[model samples]
Target: MIRFEQVSKSYSGGVQALQKISFHIQPGEMAFLTGHSGAGKSTLLKLISIMERPSAGHVFINGHDLSKVNRKQIPFVRRDIGMIFQNHRLLRDNTIFDNVALPLVIEGYGLKAIRKRVETALDKVGLLDKARYYPNMLSGGEQQRVGIARAVVNTPPILLADEPTGNLDPKLSLEIMRLFEDFNSVGTSVLIATHDLGLIARMKYRTLTLTRGRMVQDGLEASGANGVES
Candidate 1:
């Protein structure tokens, strides 16, 4: 679960990306962050991942207060949270299996465990046969699937995706969403940052909309209950 109380983020160059934002995401719940460019969706994700710190209040993940979390413990916290990126961020030199196996390998998981987890992750993403293929050898959709596999390989309790389907077609985007839903059904908390309002409109997940770096609305679905203004 994620809880942000009066959180604010101001970059070094004096640009304030988030302004007193506050919200709570329940454990095992799935939500989408909706906003236009510079609306602070990515900033929110970064705060939860400890990629950046808040200029103001607190950001709590599960029971950990991000502001009070130690530098040495950031890694341990991150291991329980998975992240997916817009570009997949796969290493061009590594095969799909290697890429998916990176997290476990980094965690010092033995070869056997890595192999089994990697295979299972790839199978879930429908990319088992492409395991031996390199990033350049797969289509955009396939590459993203590999990224998904990499994120879920560790069975993290929370999943944060930033524009994960930004590069894929609508059909592929739907497929990826369904995959996230499946993961959520198994108890993983999912927070997806996406600007695709149409794609989000079709689903019933809670929708958080932001504008001018502040939360404007938190709706239960496509309902008119949530909207913040510029």
Candidate 2:
């Protein structure tokens, strides 16, 4: 579970990216963050991942206050959260198996354990057959799936994706969303930041909308309107 209490973020130049944003994502829940560019969606995700610290207020993951977590403790905090990027950040020089196994390797897992977890993660994304292939050798969808596998290889309880389907076509986008839904069904809490309105419309999950650094709406599509005034 993640909770933000009157969180605000401002850069060195006094450029405010988020203004007193507050929301709570319950355990085993799935939600979407939708906003235009520079609307603070990515800033919110970075706060949860500890990539950026909030300038004011607090952010809690599971139960720990991230504002109190020091630099040395960030890595351990991140181990409980999985992150996916739009670009599918992977090592082109490495094989698919190596890319997905990087996290476990960094954690110093045994070879047998790494192999078992890597294969299982790849299998979940339907990319087990491409284990030996390099990232450049795979299609965009395949590469994204590999990224998803890498994100989940550690079996993190929470998943955060930023513009996960930004570069894919509609068909591929739906495929990627389905994978997230599958993960949520098994009890993982998911928070995705995206600008794809069509995709958001297709999914009935709760959505929070941001504008000019303020959270303007939060509701579900089933409640008549996709979002209610905040």
Candidate 3:
């Protein structure tokens, strides 16, 4: 779960990226966050991941107030969250298996444990067969799948994705969304920030709309899980 209480963020250059934002994402929920470029969508995700902090107001992630989060505890806070970028930030030097296994390796898990979890994560993304391939050897979709695998290898409670489907085709985008839904089905909170309106229209999850750094909407649509609202 994540909560933002009247949060606002401004860069050092005096650019205000978010303003008075407030919302709550419950556990086991998957939602789309839609907005144009510079609408504060990325800023919001960064706040949850603690990559950036708000200049005002408070941010609480899974019940810990980030305003009170100490330097020593930032890593622990991040341990409970996972994130995917549009660029599929995989290591070029590592194979798919190594990429997904990186987190567990950093956590100092045993080889047997790392293998079990990495394979499971790769399986969840339907990329287990490609585990031996390097990132450069894969297509955009495959690379993104590897990115998703890395994000979930630790079984984090929340997943933050920024424009995950931006580079994929319609069909592939749907496949990626389906994978995300499967993860949410088992209790991982997912918040995806995207500008692809066409794809978003097909994902009927509760969506929070933002414009000009303001949150404009957050609720369910009448048309079940594939509804769209402009």
Candidate 4:
């Protein structure tokens, strides 16, 4: 559902984040993006979400050309994409339910609909019992689960996670990955940018590897010896 054709991104001061990178992620696919620090994983995700425009080439989300989508259309495009980050980006002052409800609230859903959707999303992430709790009241892993719940509250067609399990313990990381797999099994396209090669190996999904801002590998079962620094 996501495609990048001959994409290149360059920043000020001669920084090249990506160079002629291209890939296609089909509907219902789950893939891992691997690379060292500054390999442009986040930059690529931003392009797909229309948060940052590519310096060159075209980015297609679902079927819409992102370059052609105007400012007024970004929110509509993002409605079909859910994003999760490494930091769990929760509001400390808000309860879990409120945090998860933010998207539907912004979409103008009524209280009843928001309540239903938030509860369902929290339940899916095994956080139904903690909906009333604040972020500080939960463990690191639980907080991450809350972030996942918030991202999927709208049941978006695509899920993009950046270093999602970066801070969790091995067990908790595995649990988090399983959650992604569950969502993917039900047909949500998933693309995760992670540094955990062991986890990637265990999951055995298609992986896209980047090095120095170029796509070096895009195939099934990335080898441990692929020479990816991350």
Candidate 5:
């Protein structure tokens, strides 16, 4: 579960990226984040992932307050989260299998276990046969799928995607959305940040909209409200 209580983030130059934002995402819930460019969507996700700290209030993840998470415990806390970026942040030199297996390898899992998880994840993304292929060898959509597989390879309970379908065509975007839904169907808490209004309308998921770093609307409070245009 994710909870933000009166959270605000300000940069060194005195630019505030988030303003007194508050929301709670329950376990096994799937939601969407929508806003215009520079609307604090990325900063909010970073706060949850601990890439950046808040200047005010608190951010709690799975019952742990991120404000009190020490540097030594950061990695352990991050292990419970899986992040997917808009850009396919794949290691071009590594094969798809190795890319997806990196997390397990970092955790010191044995070869057999890493292989099993990597293969299973690849299969889930419909790319098992492409395991030996490198990032440069795959299509854009395929590369994105590889990123998704890598993120979920370890089965982290919370999934955070920042503009996951930003670079894809409409058809491919729907396919990628469906993949996220598949994972959500299995109870992985999902929060996706996107600017695609049409896609948001089609999906009909609870949405949190930000405006100039302030939370302007939350679709959760209104039944059947997709979201207001940012």
Candidate 6:
């Protein structure tokens, strides 16, 4: 569902975040992105979400070319993508129900529809009982799950998570990853950007490794292959 062809992203003053990165993630596929601190994983996700335009080459979601998308068209394109961040990014003052309902509300869904969708998303994340609770009342894992629910409330076809498990313990991390697996099983394409090598090794999914802003490895661990490195 995501294709990047010779994509490069350079900021002002000659700071390059990505250098000619090319990769395609098929629909319903689940993959992990791993790299060092400055390897451009975040930048790559931003480009896909159209938060930043490419300096060169192209980024395509489904069959839509992002470079050709105008500013007015960006929101429409984003409706198909759900984004999760390391920090939950919830509103401190909002209840869980309100938080999860934000996307649908923004999309102008009716009150009845928003309530149903928000509850369904909360149920998926095992947070339905906490719907009336504020984010501050939840544990770290629960808070992150709330973030997940908020992201998926719109039922977007593609999900992109950036360091999603960074703040959780290994057990909580596994729980969170399993939730992503569950979503992937139902045909939502999942791309997770994480630095957890041990977790990646255990999960045995296809992994894309980056180094110095370039893709260095793309391999499936189940086959014991190190994949191509450039």
- Which model scores highest in TM-score? 4
Where is model 1 more than 4 Å wrong at Cα? 222-230
Off by over 4 Å in 6: 222-230
Candidate 3 matches the true fold with a TM-score of: 0.94
RMSD of each: 1.9, 2.4, 2.9, 1.1, 2.1, 2.5
Q: Model 3, range 1-230, lDDT digits (tens) per residue?
A: 89999999999998989999999999998998887788889999998878898999999877879989877878878878888999999999989999999888888999999999999999888889999999999999999999999999999999989999999999999999998998899999999998887776777788888777777778754223232334
Q: Model 1: per-residue lDDT, tens digit, 1-230?
A: 89999999999999989999999999999999988878899999999999999999999988778888899999988999999999999999999999999999999999999999999999999999988889999999999889889999999999999999898899999999999999999999999999887788888889888887888888865445345322
lDDT per residue (tens digit) for residues 1-230 in model 4: 99999999999999999999999999999999989879999999999888999999999877778999999999988888999999999999999999999899999999999999999999999999999998999999999999999889999999999999999989999999999999999999999999898899999899999888899899876665366753
| Model 4 local distance difference test score | 0.92
Clashing pairs in 4: none
Per-prediction backbone clash count: 3, 0, 1, 0, 0, 0
Kindly report which residue pairs in candidate 1 clash with one another. 216-227, 216-228, 217-227
Candidate 4, residue 7: CA error in Å? 0.4
Residue 135 displacement (Å), model 4: 0.8
| lDDT of residue 39 for candidate 4 | 90
Give the alpha carbon lDDT tens digit for every residue of 1-230 in model 6: 99999999999999889999999999999999988778899999999999999999999999889999999999988888989999989999999999999989889999999999999999999999999999999999999999999989999999999999999999999999999999999999999999888888899898888777888888775223243222
Residue range 140-165, candidate 2, lDDT tens digits: 98999999999999999999999999
Q: Note the Cα lDDT for every prediction shown.
A: 0.91, 0.92, 0.87, 0.92, 0.91, 0.91
Off by over 4 Å in 2: 222-230
Model 3 RMSD, rounded to 1 decimal: 2.9
TM-score of each: 0.96, 0.95, 0.94, 0.97, 0.95, 0.95
Report the number of the highest-lDDT candidate. Answer: 4
lDDT of 2 at 66: 91
Q: Candidate 4, after superposition: displacement of residue 129 in Å?
A: 1.0
